[model samples]
Target: VTLPPKIVPRINICSWTYSPPHTHTHTNPLFPSDATLEMSNLYAEQKGKTLNLTEDELLTFYGILLISGYNSVPRRRLLWSDDYDVSNTAVKDAMRRNRFDEIMSSVHLVDNMKMTADPFFKVRPLFKHMDDINKTIPIAEHVAAWCKQFIRGKPIRFGYKIWSLASSSGFVHQMEPYVGSHTHLVETGLGQGPSVILGLAEKAEVPPSAFKFYHGNLFTTLSLVDEMTLRGDGSCGTMRQTQLHNVPFTAPKTFKKTPRGDAEYLVEVEKLIVRWTDNSVVTVVSNMEREFTETEAKRWNKQKRTMDKVRQPKCIQDYNTHMGGVDLHDQFVSRNRVNIRSKKWWWPCFNWALNSKDLLSFQRLVAQTLLLRHGTKPSRQGRRSSMAVAITDATRFDSFNHWPCNTGSRYKRCKNCGGRTSFACGKCDVPLHVECFKKDHTE
Candidate 1:
């Protein structure tokens, strides 16, 4: 896949210093003591509770909470009540004041402010400097290597065998060089240039084998078509001519109109063009060995009292199935995102780290839950249970508790023992006889 040569400019890096607000000399009622004093006292008092936790274990816990969906430390404190003996106000004060070192010290977290020490912490420097052509290949290789190292305990193939790279317009340029040979790249929005494609193939360490490119109809530029035909890349001339004539350079009003069914139209050739119900046309270019195939999707035809078969392009179908992982991840991050609104330029990077932490925690939780439900060890040789079972089990037994009945004059028998009573179990919110309450709770 040879594309035109065009240089994308690299972003210039700048340095900045962060200094705490000038509140050290002033006495604030909310924060009574200095961070160091407060943290020391907190550690002395709560040391017994967290004595069992190692430094790494404590750091992991803090990392999870910091990146958790809870917007503030107070909310996080509520969840950690069972484990940590820290007050909500204390947690809030430490975070709000930006006392990272003090908090770490209090929790006995090692590395002494390692989380906050780096100004460019959690920023992807690769993306920022990718436009520097000289740096692109090295950065991609480094990132791929890092990914291979950081991810452990399971084979990468078990998760995503086919890496699907999809991003908003200009963003894809930075990522193209790293896309694996078997990867499917989906470029959304317009303004895709030939240089991006050629640069990816030329620079990326990943070989150009069975790579598929899925883009919006607008991305199928006239130059791209010319390049394909000129290279004699097995593209049908007539089909190319038809596509050049039929597919508008700009999106049409018709394309903007939403369809009621699976897709408005589907055209399959060496390349596939699918106009989906969402009023978007997707163009896919594939070099896979398999022939282009269409699957039948049945929709209920109320007027005809029958099921109507809808033809869906294999490319579109595959895109729909695999493209959702990224969206799902974004949804998870957005739903439980930390609320950090800062004027500091590095805040975005910091926020990204927090989101990453949340994502890691979410993934771990899901994996653990799945492991428990399946009762299987994490290993390549482990046999999976074929039978489908519920991920969680429902409560099997019921117990009675004592509570005061809200209904003053309403006459009813006790739910537990069938005896009339004015009081109810507040915990269970069930009416109970005084005699039955003792026996129900005891036994």
Candidate 2:
């Protein structure tokens, strides 16, 4: 996570300027007054009746959603279950189960009266709102694809293919869901890859020249690098060998025979292509300078039976340093996402929009603030782990009868810290370490 040489770290923290009533300041940004009013109006239009959703009800619903990220149940109704051990009193007190179900069913973002044949029409408004928010914060951009891929061992195996632009701080600037080849893409003419990069660059609203963009091989073409140079932006990325147009670096056969850390580079006017060998051949293309101060990277050596240092080029170092913004953003969103299931195609993306910040302290603060305003009590445990994770209901936390017992032969991952354990709650049937049993259930 080192920033590139040209980039200077700027820290600007907002103060908690809220007066006595702090509710509006915390919740309003995520769900604005106009947005909420529009949602209620849309609900009535869809359901053929008035769904008078007040500010309190909306905040409570969001609070419940936040809580569910940690305390998940197989069914939503289980939150209000009749069984004392499994039931949640705060949830039951905040809203009726049927009312929750009603809101879920009628949560419309756009009017159905203006329906189109497009699959994305339902959730289009949400993306628009997100993009509008991004415009308010001026920053350079990077790109990534959020999609369901059949790629082996990929974590996100089933999701929509969303092309997104994110800043160096992991803030998403804009997003467009990819449909297919017929879907509109910028005509960079180099291919779909360059087109996506250019499209995202254009959408970011900043002068293209202001960006020092970094991308992976998927979007890096020789022409794309040249195109970025023409647009006055510096660029660097790993390149597919095929996109190289047969640039004569040491021939692939000869390059394989060279010693580890050996590098062959071609310097054209204002562009650089480098092939460096470590465990595998790394081909990097950059519009930056040909020569840069070289650094060393530790690599495992099978022959020496130890880690050895390999020479690393500046372009490769810069790419590594700045290329993880989208990935970091993905990591933040994936963690602590609400465990809400839906048949709608847009549910995951909608949930993603809400869970933008995966900071547990913020989530816990927001959850407690909103829920407590409606009479839900905070956790009695004062010195719990900062992580907002729990498997059991908060209402059941005070039931002093719980204990851990061995599972005899089976070992399962601990619910508290993900360590392997054979011991588990005697009643709940969840695995946990002996020391974590109390904290896990109570927190």
Evaluated with TM-score, which candidate comes out highest?
2
lDDT of 1 at 431: 71
- Please name the candidate that would achieve the greatest lDDT relative to the true structure: 2
Question: What lDDT does candidate 1 reach at residue 238?
Answer: 11
lDDT of 2 by residue, 304-398 (tens): 89988778777777677666666666787777888878786677777777777647778768776777795433334223222222434643475
Question: In model 1, which range of ten residues has the least summed lDDT?
Answer: 10-19
Q: In candidate 1, what are the lDDT values of residues 41-79, reduced to their tens digit?
A: 445456533223233333333434443445344533332
> Cα miss at 400, model 2 (Å)?
16
lDDT of each: 0.34, 0.66
What lDDT does candidate 1 reach at residue 412?
60
Candidate 1 achieves a global lDDT of: 0.34
